[model samples]
Target: MSNDRSKPWFAPKRYGYGAGLPITWQGWALTVGYVLIFIGVINFSEQDKPGSNFMSVVGMSVFVVATIAYILICAAKTKGGWRWRWGGKP
Candidate 1:
């Protein structure tokens, strides 16, 4: 929404576009939660045999939606926003 860049929770990458590691506890929590949700979704979606090719469409859809939402939130919380960088100053 805005490029105010005030107290960002995530830092921008040094050499390329996108956010890097979390710079705040909130960011860390968000990342950890996402990972947990991802694992849960996969396990729940494939409740069949160990090597089954059956995946719940609903579970996969939820995962995809969550992933997109996470990306958008990360981009918004990243310092200097998301953009290309050549290892220069922010």
Candidate 2:
């Protein structure tokens, strides 16, 4: 015989072993931002001309700004953003 039981409303959902924090939209944003910033910085450093790499520098700056902005926004908007996992929650 098979038995099925409905969980109580207040009971926490059972996650599989080693289940980690769920990913949120802000996590995706931060990841993309960091990747862009890293690639931009590396590309900018590799350019040899006096002004040839200016765009890359600008790109990197934009990415840094975007990352900071998104982080702040996520802090205000989400409970599962990176900061929450880092220090925002117990």
Candidate 3:
């Protein structure tokens, strides 16, 4: 093995256990938005009200859409795009 320090400490590894958190503002926003929506849904569901099923469906849809958007954003940042590869490059 060679002491290859060409890559910066923040640069992602081609193969490793896993990459850390999102490096972009959009990524962080999406993550925080998802969490807030999730919490809101849980609180709303716990209330005694009619049409809870409909609310649940809507919440689920929002969650799914957010998740897909987050995934796509991450993919766009990576070279392999949705595959297991290194990211955080210029």
| TM-scores, all models, native as reference | 0.83, 0.39, 0.54
Reference-based lDDT, each prediction: 0.88, 0.48, 0.55
lDDT of 2 by residue, 1-90 (tens): 532222111211133221132245445655566677678777766674675867666766776786687545444433322221232222
Better of 1 and 3 by lDDT: 1
**What ranking of all candidate models by lDDT puts the best one first?**
1, 3, 2
Best-performing candidate as measured by lDDT: 1
* TM-score of candidate 3 on Cα atoms, chains taken together: 0.54
- Residue-level lDDT for 24 in candidate 1: 89
Error of 3 at 23 (Å): 2.2
lDDT, residue 34, model 1: 93
User: What order do candidates take by TM-score, descending?
Assistant: 1, 3, 2
The alpha-carbon deviation from the true structure for residue 84 of candidate 2, after best TM-score superposition, in angstroms, is: 9.7
List candidate 3 segments past 4 Å from native.
Answer: 1-19, 48-52, 85-90
* Candidate 3 displacement at residue 13 in angstroms: 6.8
Q: What is the C-alpha RMSD of each candidate to the true structure, in Å?
A: 4.1, 11.1, 8.8
